[model samples]
Target: MSADEHITQRNSSVSGNDTKGSTEYQTGGIHDFKTQPNESCSFTTLKSNTDEEAAIPLMVGDVHLAEAQELWSTVRDKAVKLRMDRSGLGSQPPMTVHQMFMATVQKFGEYPALRVKKDRTWVTLTYNEYYQHSRAAAKSFMKLGLERFHSVGILGFNSPEWFIADVGCILAGGLSTGIYTTNSPEACQYVADDCKANVLVVENNKQLTKILQVRDQLSYLKAIVQYKGELEQKLANVYTWAEFMKLGENVPDAKLDALINSQSANECCTLIYTSGTTGSPKGVMLSHDNITWTASAAGHMIKLKMAEEEVVSYLPLSHVAAQINDMWISMRIAGVTSFAEPDALKGSLGNTLREVRPTRFLGVPRVWEKMQEAMKAVGKNSSVMKRIISDWAKVIGLQASYNTMNGVSSAPWGFTLANILVFNNVRKALGLDRCRACYTGAAPITKDTLEYFMSLYIPIFELYGMSESTGPHTMSWAEGHRIMSCGKVLNGCKTKIDKPDADGNGEICFWGRHVFMGYLNMPEKTENALDADAWLHSGDLGKHDKDDFLFITGRIKELIITAGGENVPPIPIENALKEKVSIISNVMLVGDKKKFLSMLVTLKCNADDNGDPTDDLTPQVVEFCQQCGVVASKVSEVINKKEPAIYKAIQEGIDHVNAKATSNVQRVQKWTILPQDFSISGGELGPTMKLKRPVVNKMYQEEINKFYSE
Candidate 1:
């Protein structure tokens, strides 16, 4: 036979039933089944590129792959080699994403890997089925002309298709990029253009419109696939999910196998765009090693058990935190992940949580805060006797939680009774009854929110890291965690406080395999983040406690400098003020280049159907006002009338916070209540609800100037 004919014959050897067959998509909801242990399904094993491969692409988009190789090799040669005995980097050899997935499938082929709601039924996909679908998707991507080192931008919420597309992209030797569902058409274009996306997979026609609006500008975009709803327009190059999945049915298995085998652990496989609180989003390039290694190490740190963890995936997958929790960590430990409803943040999340009863839960600070507010509202409406009982139970619960956190062996009196009477019911109501661990991160969480949850016997631990570190560097867990600390560093990771002050607080730096392969196409930024020693310099300011617990103080960029050149961290003061003032919802301290610190405060108010803050106060705030003898129902009434009781309470709270300040400069000399609360729609907050200080400054520039002018 001729050489070309021989290669073609070899590629087509695998039968259609073996390579292209798919599990029947089930309708309605099916509950999770308990299959016998040792029940397993077959998974294909691909050739490992053990030796250096010459076929690996030299360039990915505008990034030179060799540059990343040199950078990580230096760290591997220096720190990794020297700390071989102590650090985790030395213990495990590097592996690609394919290897990690194979390992998981081998151990948990029959275990449920994903659960999606269809009508009222919850349908599940086993690990083996998940792998098979991803492979089929990979073939389709290859059939669509995806090239090596190119990208597939998945723009959607968390779904089965999202997971499949992401894994499929990586399997086909292309980069997987997630675009925030909230991104505008222009923003979508920027990411698509930056990643040189070969295909864009959107959740619905709404997102499809975004890509279509900018499609003319995206030179590299080859195909568009909508995972939900029918295409509004039957344009050329646009395909439905069904059509897209069928494109590669005729493609040979050997075609995808070749690309998978040519992959390396050191090369970038995914891009996580920073939410860009400080500026425009930058693509954070994470290598295969970064994802697989961090998944294993962090999973172990949190004590995730194989097939035992059940988690809700609702947060924006574009953020590294959600991606790690919903995708990587679950994949690593062979856990079941259920996708939350599309309106999760809009209030459907509670219903999903109640149904799933996840064994673990992760929420941003805002989510926890909202839950706290909802619970408080319910408590206020309870009968007199019930309220008395709940109040007593909460006190006992809080005391017990504190004792356990402090490592004191003696349980508080009535602790078990409190757990039965109040704590268990609270957990069940919030759908966290089976949760072994509940975590909060992506922004600073107030001690008030933490203590409130502790009062309910649900202590929310915090994890700290950025997109560049591939999700988590320091984590807080159940066994060994301080109330406000971000916990100790992960086993294989190292942290350093650069140039500490008298209190030992400084910029936090990370050294680990989790550090990303630099920002794509931004060399100056890459140099700024990773110093000469290869440590990823987190712009976040933090300090270590005597017992090695990590406490994040503030960010270097967020620090406010006075005219006298004294640096002041704002969050601590803001948190303190909010705690003291029950009616206050949000506060931002402003004193940069000023004589004294001032603040812009927002009252707790009801949100309209559109989620915009209305003029009316929330129920909790109204109750607070009633207690203060104010009798106000709206924020406008309190502000326009200058209600004495309300203003007096605010003054008292400010005074209480100022009394604890170390210096006169730290005191709030002047303050004003914003007519409306800061919100994501208002452009004062990021997608994860993190405060955007720069945006806030610009929005409230006129109000801020009034304080200085006086």
Candidate 2:
């Protein structure tokens, strides 16, 4: 038999186990999967070359018999309609998320799909079990009176329950919406009411309490399910996760299957609400095809191998990048996804990464910066001999990385020795030893962070997209990536720079099946986003290089026009300042309608137990202060004392950046360092760590006015 056939034969009988009573399966603990490690395992592609034969089983539960099909006929047909070029990807039928899950489980039934750490032991859920559980959850959702096109709002961190609830809602013909964990009770109510949510899935009592506070205001909410904690107080229509899973026992599988079969690839199945940094959050409607096609396209572009990719899930799934990278792409390629702890952002992420040793990782810019800071702190305390060796290795590693990025085959002298001595150890410490592709997106990453990682032989590629475009539109791969550019557009997607200036910068527009089905219930806003021809105007300024690599310049809404009528993009100058001054954590430029530009800067500091930025300086920042001959351990001390050494160092760095400014309007005339760093809890950053410009402006209006007065 062929390799594919061997995989099919192994998994053909796996779904039979689900015929057992629901309680029997539900009662099984973590030990059940552990005992039957090899039971009904598989890894295979489809066998069919024709669309008709393959799609015949796209109905309920017949995914097992279809065998792994080889042809992309259905995909090709859909591609033609979307006007997408269909050269690669062979032949395959378009699939709903449910159909895709079923088909994948049929081939990889016993493969470890979701792994979560409980206490000290690792719990595994095979692909088949994942499907069966999601199906059960779908029935429960139907039992809870979920109406077609209504929403199921999930509020939580990344976990197995979060993933299952999202998929289950889609399978039950309801919109799956993710609400940020940091959202207040009012924000939670707005999302629930706006989507007309029939069900809300909370991670714990913390999230559950938010729903309960506004439950009276939610007209369409029928039930609330808390996945993580016990009920301290009895409330009607609220159930524990275990109790909720059993509610669907009486609901037949055939009924749920019919709903799944009714789903069309072209219709919206998911809702992504924007961060609403400027205004109220608007839901961006994403079709079944948008998720499946974009996942497949992105995976293909990055050359993700089937059943080989492994990733850590920590970023907020409410954001499109995390949803696409951690959930959808894993489903597409049958990759293993391990959930990180709730405190992953605070510091525990490193421990989880070391344990999981994922093959692919995606992080926002802040995550990368944190890693950079941690490593620098360690290096600062290292022995003199080790530091010397590390410095030499880094020089060699950086040269090798630059050469590879430029498509040069030649490596510098002692490159192999350097990797063996320092580069490899550094990667292994960061738990990136197995990571083949590391991605950074959701915000602009500094060149300093990029080059810092590159010196250690890890190239962090950039991804560019928005919720309206269904995650990633342009991707930078390891082989052909530029440091600052967001890389080339994905295959089957077209990018247009609408009305370029003399510098070739313009509003970036997108055209693809990945373009969303317009903002939910907001035609005016939808019309503003999607033009008449269905092209998505991103409202971001960018330009393509001669090699066609896209570089984002700035957001049109964020452009600062000075009193002299000069247009200035704050990002370049902001990035320059941060790069020049290593101690600066965040920077915001202020000069709109003013004579000259000024800035609000924040120092690097530690976060408190509540995730709020504290006055205490971080280790790296403390070391920098010592280097500058200043004795200070707190941001308040440095600012209050106006420490001459620290101030002199910052001023010197500012002068260096000013010397390189392109125009007088772009130069910083004055700047003030804030006492605390910007953070999510402080209301200065969005969920994905994108700066909330208007909020920051208002918070520091006094300081900003002082700059102009002086």
lDDT of 2: 0.80
**Candidate 1: tens digits of C-alpha lDDT, residues 1-710:** 11111112111111111111111111111112122112222322211112222211111111011222134321211111111111122223445788778877887899999999988899999999999999989999998999887899999989999999999999998889999887889999999998889999999988998888999999999999999989888999999999999999998988788888777666788999987767778988888878887887677777677778999999989899999999998887889999998878878999999999999999999899899889888888899998999999889888888888888888788988888989999999999999999998999998999999998889999999989889998898888799889997876666778778788888888766688877888778888998765667899888888888889999899899999999999999999998888789889999999999999999988776656678889888888888888888998889998889898889999999999999998999899988899887787877788998998999999999999998
Model 2, residue 695: distance off in Å is: 0.9
Off by over 4 Å in 1: 1-69, 72-90, 629-631
* TM-score of every model versus the real structure: 0.88, 0.89
The lDDT, on a scale of 0 to 1, for candidate 1 is 0.80
Question: Per-residue lDDT for 1-710 in model 2, tens only?
Answer: 11111112111111111111111011111112222211332322332222112111221222111112211111211111222222222212345787678767987899999999998789999999999899999999999999988999999999999999999999999999999999999999999998889999999989998889999999999999999978888799999999999999999889988888766665568889988878999988887777887887787777788888899999999999999999998987889999999999988999999999999999999999999988988898899999999999889888998999999999999998999999889889999999998999999999999999999999999999999889998899987699899987876566778778888888888766577767777868877886645567899999888888899999999999999999899998889889988899999999999999888999999998767899999888888888888899999999999998888888888888889988766788898989889999889998888999999999999999899887
Which ranges in model 2 have alpha carbons more than 4 Å from their true place? 1-93
